[model samples]
Target: MPTTPVVSRRRVMAALFTGVACMNIAMAGASTAGVLIATESPGPGWSGVPSAAGVLGTAAGALGSARLVVSHGRRRSLLITYGLGSFGALLAAAGAVTGLFPVLLVGLLVLGLGNGGAQLSRYAAADLYPDERKGQALSAIVWAGTVGALAGPPLIAPAARTADLLGLPGLAGPLLVAALVTAAAAVVSAALPRSIPDAHPRTPETSGSEGFAVAFAQRAVRGPLLAMVAAQVAMVAMMTMSAPQLHQHGHGLDVVGWILTAHMIGMFALAPLSGRIADRWGGRVTIFAGIGTLAVASAAAVAAPTSHTAGIPLSLFLLGYGWNLVFVGGSSLLSTQHRKLQGTVDAVVWSTSALAGLAAGPLFALGGYVLVAVVAGVAALIPLVALTDH
Candidate 1:
């Protein structure tokens, strides 16, 4: 295996970290604005459009960015991705100002593309480090999201006020902030040097779907990818639809916000520790633990009564941690794959997550939250059972 110089690797890692953190800041703010945009329409017909568009964009972005990475190297590909994000944010802001729903959707879709590029940065970071160090590096990048989660929300009102001063719609303020922040991400991404010793050879992956098929046929690729996908499906389905269940139970938006905060803490706060666990115990054990925790969390949700809000939050926290473990562990395992396949796998992960989210409402309505939790649990078990062969 090749080795990157420690200094060079660290510099690139720091760049990826800063870029992803900034992108998330934009994402959170834009997401809030998107929800508002969706709600601007009467009734519940369009409530989920913004999120759906973003997810679909993320899926497309991941595939497109990965191809670019194959042909153009990390730096150039990242530049294009984040540039798209910034432009998308600006377009979305224009939609807000003009009251054009289609424009807002298009902008969000583009912003999600940029976000997809940022998501792939974790893989680029992995490529810079040795096998032993990949977990720590990936975790460090994932941990950067905590900064966005903490900082993004507070900026919304101020951004809205700033927009008011500019004579734009108040919601456009956050989108404007998103534009600036994503452009900063583009700048940070521009600073990434070729950290790989044998960097950017333009692999066969750029050729066509055949390359992806061959790569995915490998045992190493299949296990980690499947585990990662399961984690995503479970997490998105359970988490996205939980709010409706809370609402049905008469819980207010404040309670929902507080619970989601707990979930974010569970997701991002202990990422370094999660990385350590993966590095120490190996991916198989880490994924097993993750699956177990997720299954338990799902069961807990079913067991907890509506009035028992405390239990619900605890379950959500557990859900987030479970997802972190699966994702971090699976990613570390997948790190050894060909560079071109990285973005492709992530694209599939996001697409599956979007589908799960779309199905969540219907699943929840069928048997209420119980059915959704059951479905998530079933999804979690797929990789668990299959990876037993690993």
Candidate 2:
């Protein structure tokens, strides 16, 4: 009898991780540019454009990617999304050079779509492992973001220099760099072996919309989804406004960069430990702990004086750490809930999260930093009320 060929899980995981890291590099770079470009926009209240566009783009991307994953498989979905991201980056760069706000906004939205697709790579990592080890695998892929997060911001200056050499606007440099990195990621994604199994078998009857309907019908699934949404809303709302708030308080750009880096570290550096905690203690316990931490961090942000430099960074770090816990815990729980509807379930989580993020900018504009923090703290408590041990 002929034996079946054995696929190397390690090699496949390595490829996924590499692709994820490259995507992160593009994401981080684009994110930095998004903020700066938004700040430079001529229109009043345009600072939120990128954030809103990001949220909207993510919603669209999540739905589209989910459908593609259901029909075509993960590698093809990733390849297409990354290509979209590269094109978006180029558009953004062009917008920067020409000072076209609409073009820039559109680019940010498309770039965000790319991020949405990359976010699913974590689930893909988990798919390769057994249930008991899913948390670790997911967190390992998430931890890969640390490399890109650390490397991305520092490139701003270098990117500026490159832009000058190429006779482009300085602000356009990061977007151009984003385009290159994401394009490379597309190539890497295209190389992914088709033999790697999906997390769940696709069902022809369950289209993306039907999958959402089915997943949302379950109480167990709703709990995790709500947890993820609250975490994302709170984290993105606060983190998005942090730089401008600090800059308004007279902090330098370099300081903002360092603080953002610290936040990223909090988000990704300790993810493995968070995963282990979830596995050992149960996701419910871990989620409660995460919410508690987030509450404390938000309270700290509200209480700390604007001049207290150390306080803000510390609070941001705590916020990121809290987000990491909830994110990992909630994701693990979701993965276990309905294996067959993984793509749609993930899409719903991201789309809801994106809607919350879209609201964040306007919230900040209307209520200021304190209001954002207060609202985030309150939002974090909703999961506590909704989630129960199953």
Candidate 3:
């Protein structure tokens, strides 16, 4: 008798991690390009517009992808989202060539949708592993992002040279790279298994509202949800403004890239350790550690001089590190609870994060980096209100 062949979980996870790494490359490249383009444009407070639009798209995309995951599956949803990202990157490239700010904004919005979908990859990783290793699985996938994140900023110069050689606008070069990478991600996503192990299988009769109610009713879920939201708000608000703020203080692109690279390292380099901490000590304890780290980081940011020096990079790194702990720990907590409602729970988390990103621009404009840092510090403290011994 012929035996059925089984796909290895390790292979599936490896493919997923590769896709996520590619997606992060595209995202980081777009971010660097957006900052340069927006800064060079003649306008007051326009630097944040692209990021805001992208974040709004991310919010919408998260909800949309969640619904698609519920209806179709992870593979299809990821493919569609990556396709949208490719289209968005093309638009962004064209906009850069034409020097059209509005078009660039629109393109970034579309790209954000893809980003939202990519964020789901972490959750998918959790589904593939046993409960005890959930944190490790999720963090391993997230750690894959380090490759792209660290590489993207450095590629800005090379991409610009490539654009010049191709007779395209220098700023548009990264977007072109983004388009190619995102398309590759889509192809890779197509190879994902039809069904993930331990994934929640709901009937067509199940509704998003039903999932949401189930998640909200549980205290275990609610606390982690709040921690995730707070972490996102604090992280996004500070990180988005860091580049522009440094640029305004007369830092060059290379310097900015280096600082951002350091930040990205902090974000992904310690994922394995963070995951182990979460698994061994519990998510709540990890969250508390993250909050304390964020508090100190924010204080350092407020005190750091506006120079192209080690101070800013160190501060940013700390900030990123703190965010990583909260994100991985909180996500593990969520994954452990109400596994059946994963999609809806993720939607809520991403949507809240999107809103926070959207709000960051105006907040920065109002009170400068110090105000933003203060606000972020305050937000970081929110998880304390819902702390539990569990």
Instruction: Please give the ranking of all candidate structures by lDDT, highest first, separated by commas.
Output: 1, 3, 2
**Estimated TM-score for each candidate:** 0.86, 0.90, 0.90
Candidate 1 residues lying further than 4 Å off, grouped into runs, are 36-42, 154-171, 194-210, 242-258, 303-309, 364-371
**Model 2 regions lying over 4 Å from their true place:** 1-7, 198-210, 305-308, 337-340
Q: Candidate 1: give the clashing pairs.
A: none
Instruction: Tell me the lDDT of model 1 at 60.
Output: 82
TM-score of model number 2: 0.90
lDDT of 3 at 41: 88
The superposed Cα distance between candidate 2 and the true structure at residue 285, in angstroms, equals 1.7
Candidate with more favorable, higher lDDT: 2 or 3: 3
Candidate 2 residues 227-340, lDDT tens each?
A: 878887788777777766775677755676677777778888888998898788877777888899899889988887263367677878888889889888888886654333
**Regarding TM-score, does 1 or 2 come out ahead?**
2
91: Cα error in model 2, Å? 0.7
Q: How far is each candidate from the true structure, as Cα RMSD in Å?
A: 3.4, 3.1, 3.2
Which of the two candidates, 1 or 3, achieves a greater TM-score against the reference? Answer: 3
Q: RMSD of model 3, in Å?
A: 3.2
lDDT tens digits, residue span 143-170, model 1: 8887776767567767888889988888
